[model samples]
Target chain A: MTTVHTAASAVSAVSAASAAEEKVDTCASEAAHPPPVARGGYTISEVVSHTGLSAHTLRWYERIGLMPNVSRSHTGQRRYSEADLGWLSLVGKLRLTGMPVADMVRYAELVREGEHTFAERQHLLTRHRENVRQHIAELQDTLAVLDFKIEHYADARRASERV
Target chain B: MTTVHTAASAVSAVSAASAAEEKVDTCASEAAHPPPVARGGYTISEVVSHTGLSAHTLRWYERIGLMPNVSRSHTGQRRYSEADLGWLSLVGKLRLTGMPVADMVRYAELVREGEHTFAERQHLLTRHRENVRQHIAELQDTLAVLDFKIEHYADARRASERV
Candidate 1:
């Protein structure tokens, strides 16, 4: 009935922590960038690699207003800034929590409006935080059910071996 | 810095516990029924209400082999037994875990094979259990980030009031 959370899953947990650290809302000044790029911004492929979001998803995020006013290169290619990566990392977290895209776009809109929306942002995230906790509790219940069934199978296996 | 989990979400937790109790795999002999319906079968609508799955989804579950061999009534209406309700309950929990439908259909096939597949079922569930735990851990990380930002908002609100 006991299942070990393996090293592979642990690595994902570690990465999730780093992603959390990248959350840009509180301190845009602390945004981490790689060495200065050709035009001082990340290319689409670089963002895709760093965020593990598809190039299509990055473009779509911008199109849908999830990523607002992304700077363009001299030739008009998308050039993501360090702050953009931070917001994308946080968006990835909310997406994992299954926050609807419409809500995320609203949240992004608030982000763009700046300081005045902090209270509203707090309320929105608090509501969503509650949702995520309920979601975790449900998954835990599923784990219990799985454990019970696994134990039943184990018992049956032991009985069959004795036969 | 502090958020109440709230009575609304608390009620959902209570229901999830009962839903887990409805899980049918471990003790089919203990399947609960709502006073015996006509022909000892639940109508599709009744199962829909009991399981909170849409009629379309219930049928699709059958179509995808996630629900195997649901008996039909004389007029070709779906006849759900107490055991079927139990299976649906378990299936709903797994669905909440976001287990891939293809894997769930395979799990249903294993369930239909019965005792001989117990070991395989154990292995399958063990793998999924690990996945669910990893998911829960990621959600917790998200919660931590939300908490940090919420606290930052609280600070801003406090400072703005002093002006």
Candidate 2:
């Protein structure tokens, strides 16, 4: 009976692993186009082209301690692997949302600790989401103001033309 | 005929000024209620209390040249006037919207040049608005990811608890 139970558990473990593998595959395809940084390492220029970020800004981000130390080729040039690109894509998303460099550094610290700090990472992200939500609401407010101003100016132009 | 036209324009100007003066009177009422600081001058402590910002942070911001030179009283203490507070409020709003200190300084330069730079100021603000709009869109994208992650974790939590 113990042997049979062990066999059943072994079957469950295999099935779980297979399901997780499938999820990973699906995620790989669904994440982005161009297959996510391709296979091997890419040069800094290649990375810049693929990522749509300027090389100087990328360097500045690295120098400001915003990005982790990238891997280097034997010739001392930066070589970004697939994982590094994925990480950068996430960082880009965060930055595009106007997350401060200091806050991102703190998040990066949590990420470097691995899965043990998942709760903290989640909390930080949630807080940032709240901030973003408030910002979006404010933007909507300002967009309304802009639309009003634009219309008012257009009316003034129309009146001036008539004169 | 010219006198009549000039008289009509003068009357219109007086009405406009009266409307503006009434609005200011309304603002002064709110500004003075339980007044945040004394009428003549405010110490650094008063500024900190009213702004809900730390003294160290305030000094750091000023030291980093983010703030203008604050006026000093005869006792060598910072003396903040109502104009200073008003300017600080605008700065706070810009900072909350993630405008960099450097960019704020650029905007301030245009402001200090007065109405001669009105077109430049408008251009800067228009560009900043576009940046903010893009930032908001990126945040919406991240918010979607966060919602997915939160739901995934919540489901996992329930599944584990069930076991």
Candidate 3:
């Protein structure tokens, strides 16, 4: 009975490995011919072109824990998956709003901690959105000031020309 | 004729000095009783409070030629005039729009060069205004993405709770 149980365990392990291998095969085919949305894997340069981020910034993001651990090729070069590209895209947007690097790292940690941190992640993003709103309002006020000053300059120029 | 010229020059000098003293008296009275709009001369600390800038930053502005040479008191302390405060206010607004310090210094120089630089200053401000507009549009787009992600998190939380 003990021998039969051991055989059954071996069979289950083999089945799991086979399933993983099948998934890898699908990934391999996708990697060979990348889609427009970047489903499979990409090189560092490919990611740079796709995301418009410099290679230095990308490496810095990885070092700062703003990015998840990227996969590696057999020769030990970095390989970025589609999921990585998606994360980078989000990071790029967050950066444009001048979100602090530390806050971005915290958000990344929440992402890696799984689905339970969703609520907390939402709260972080909501707070940042409010900040962005305030910044937009301030810029609008500055714009109004610029408009007034520009008109004043126009009048001054005309007056000088008349003189 | 030399004696007459000397007497006339001395009289003119005394008249100019007296006028300046009278202006200082008015400024001293205003400084003694600070107003809401902050006219007259202000001490370093007073300017700090009014502009919400640190004393260090104010000095740095002067050092970098971003500000004109502020008037000095008898004790060699900085004394900011109403015109200086007005210039600082405009600088504060420009800083908010992320204008570079070098560009601001250039603008300050143009102001000091008299009325001839009006067209150039106006051009610089107009270009900066365009940049601000683009920034605002990009931020609005990012805000939309944040809204979408926040909603997704909400739905995910609800789904998990049901499970």
Candidate 4:
């Protein structure tokens, strides 16, 4: 009876060990598939292709110090981490919103200095959003002008046909 | 009857002349309303306040030869005509669409030479539209990433609350 009881305990121990091993394997897999925040990094060429900005513009952006100090490979090629891409993606938005490059450089400077300028950054972004809103309004107006021109030509064509 | 008819005809002719003169007065009033597109033209300062572009940028655009030469005032200040404003409006569109100032200068040269380069102008504008389209796509993607990040932070907040 004592021998049987000891065997039962040993078997349960082995099963627990197997279960623990399985749990570790699951954890390993989970580590490999981290959330969005866990992206390893990206290279400059990758960034250029992804962002659709020219290599020259990228270099120019760095030269103007609009970009943060980027890491480099042993070969001296710029290496970008996920954080860098996140920052650049914001820069892209600012550029699209028509913030001048000079103004963007100033904004970048503020960003590099850290969270003390959060209010300033937020203010700048809010101002830019307003500007973009105004720009879209202007674009809508011009688009109406274009529509009128198109209709004018179409009407003239119809009139010529009638003649 | 002939004398009566002659008098009546003279009176009719005078009435018709007066009607024509009234039409001319209406045209003249309309012309004077805007002063025939300001033949005396605008100074650099006037263009600045009118267009909301900086005076320095306007001069730089001219100096870079992206803008057509404007007539100079007797005091040698730059005088811009209505046509210049129209052209500048086009330039603003190109600039807003992310065409480099240098490329715009080339385009301006093509334009100054007249209608022979219509195809080239179309090509340039078409290419720029493509660029803008690509930029828009990239911005959409970046916006998605930003949304993701913002959501992640929100989720983290929720998770902390659960904890």
Candidate 5:
């Protein structure tokens, strides 16, 4: 549960300039011209609630260099911007693909490293995409097996009733 | 690694009658008329390679009553049948769906309980099928994110080169 007013007031207490809105996509497509609160940002607990990631995991992501540069409040609390949330949203999806955390960290490093790593990042993502496709196919194949077994069981039940 | 000759000879040494080849789908469709070795069955090592499950896991399946009727050799070595392999194959597929082992064990129980549990088993499988589909959907969504990021990087690279 998050208290929006309290979080916003905390964000207000931090005197930082608004992050420049550029079309430059760092990790994901951020909200265009975010509100002062959106740009000023969310607290760690707010981020935890919004992303369904624990505070520890958020901290760990920063520690492992899996996260981009996160701004801090005047009191030194981490203040996550809309762009950070956008990046986190991408990371959340990546986690679902079961990609190795190390690979994700590498991708983050590449992003932080700049456009020179574009080709390498694309290659890594393409390979993971292939893996996800294969994983889906495997699950689809099992659905057929489950269907076959279910149908057979239904037939067996009917035959038993007749006897 | 599975040795066809040594494993076959080892199987034939066991004095088990040919498994009846009725089209009765207990777990899965079996090879109608298996050769003497196929009927007599494969050694645990052979099954390990075939199913990609460890020997410890195979034995654990037996211990937990997750296995169907697995026959034994003269020296008490497990002889996995074609039907047994079929069942194990299905089990392997179920594991890929990320279904809990307890749930899988329950499905095994329903199968072992006979035709009376047909409806319940079907319901359980149908639910699992839904979960698998949703999981696939989630992965597919992530693919789009990966595509967006990759394309953005490619564009950024081109821009940087032009400058």
Candidate 6:
């Protein structure tokens, strides 16, 4: 009975290890070509493709202090890390909201200052969120006006046709 | 009896005329200093204040054909009409949505072309409204990300204080 119990426990352990390996494999496959393991570093061209930003714009972002200093590969080309990609993603979203480049640079500065500046970073984001909210409200109001104007045009067109 | 009926009718007529006059006064008062009657001709400075656009920008807009030609007074000073104010208001809203200046110029051209372009104008506005809606959606999503990040910072700070 002791031997049988030991054998069963060993089988269960083997099954569990196999399951964990399968999970990892699944995750790696799901991420495919850009798997986390392979994403330790990216070339400038790779980042340009991933972020859909022009090479010129990426260089400009770096020059304007929007991006932190990128590491260099053996040949001296820019090599962006996972954290850099994450930062670029956030910057892309911020740019969509029409936040000025200067403001983004400020945020980047706060980030570079590390854990001590977390409160300031949070405050900056809160203020920017408020600005975005106000902008969204304004856009909604403008949308209503546009809808009204469009409807007027449609009614006028129908009336003209009826005439 | 006829005299009494005539007196009643006269009273009603006077009340109706007074109501009409009151409506006119209400409208004028609601508009305040920049009443429509007074809006027939605004100087450059007046347009600048009304539109919150710099005089330089106003001139630039005019140069770019984004604005219709302004009339000149006896001394050749530019006089913007109520219609011009209305157009500027529309332009301001469009600008808020980040519509390209060239597109705005096209819209201005459509306006100058008159009634036949109503369909095209409506199409342009409809397209712009869609763009604005998409932009609002993107901003809302970004806001959510910011809120999440802010909450993370708050949590981190709380943890540090506890330590």
lDDT of 4 by residue, A36-81 (tens): 2233345666666666666787788999999868777767877765
Checking candidate 2 for backbone clashes, the offending pairs are none
Candidate whose DockQ is highest: 1
> Could you tell me which 10 consecutive residues in candidate 5 chain A have the lowest summed lDDT?
A1-10
- Order of quality (DockQ): 1, 5, 3, 6, 2, 4
- Which regions of candidate 3 fall more than 4 Å away from where they truly are? A1-40, B1-40, B158-163
Worst 10 residues of 4 chain A by lDDT: A1-10
DockQ of every candidate structure: 0.42, 0.13, 0.28, 0.05, 0.30, 0.27
True contacts kept of 4: 0.03
Give the per-residue lDDT of model 4 (tens digit) for B1-163.
0011112222223223323332222133444454323435677876776556678978898899987688887778787776677677666655544467777898899879875565566566555555555544534443443454345445655666698
Residues B1-163 of candidate 3: C-alpha lDDT, one tens digit per residue: 0011112222323223333433333433454656523442578887776666678988999999998879887788888876677677777766765677888999999999988899999999898888778668767877887898899899999999999
User: Residue by residue across A82-148, what tens digits does model 2's lDDT show?
Assistant: 5565666666656555567677888878767776666777778777777667667756655554455
- What do the candidate models score in CA lDDT, each in turn? 0.73, 0.58, 0.70, 0.56, 0.68, 0.69
Q: If you assessed candidate 2 against the hidden native complex, which CAPRI class would it receive?
A: incorrect
Give residue A66's lDDT in candidate 2 (0 to 100). 67
- On TM-score, the stronger of 3 and 5 is 3
Candidate 3: give the clashing pairs: none
TM-score for each of the candidates: 0.79, 0.56, 0.76, 0.50, 0.72, 0.75
Per-residue lDDT of model 2, residues B100-122, tens digit only: 67777777777677655656666
Which candidate, 2 or 5, has the higher lDDT?
5
Those runs of model 2 whose alpha carbons end farther than 4 Å from true positions after fitting are: A1-45, A52-84, A98-121, A135-163, B1-39, B54-76
Clashes of each: 0, 0, 0, 0, 0, 0
User: Residue pairs in steric clash, candidate 6?
Assistant: none
Please give the distance, in angstroms, between residue A7's alpha carbon in candidate 2 and its true position after superposition: 53
Off by over 4 Å in 6: A1-40, B1-40
Model 1 residue A29 distance off true place after TM-score fit, in angstroms? 17
lDDT of 2 at B118: 55
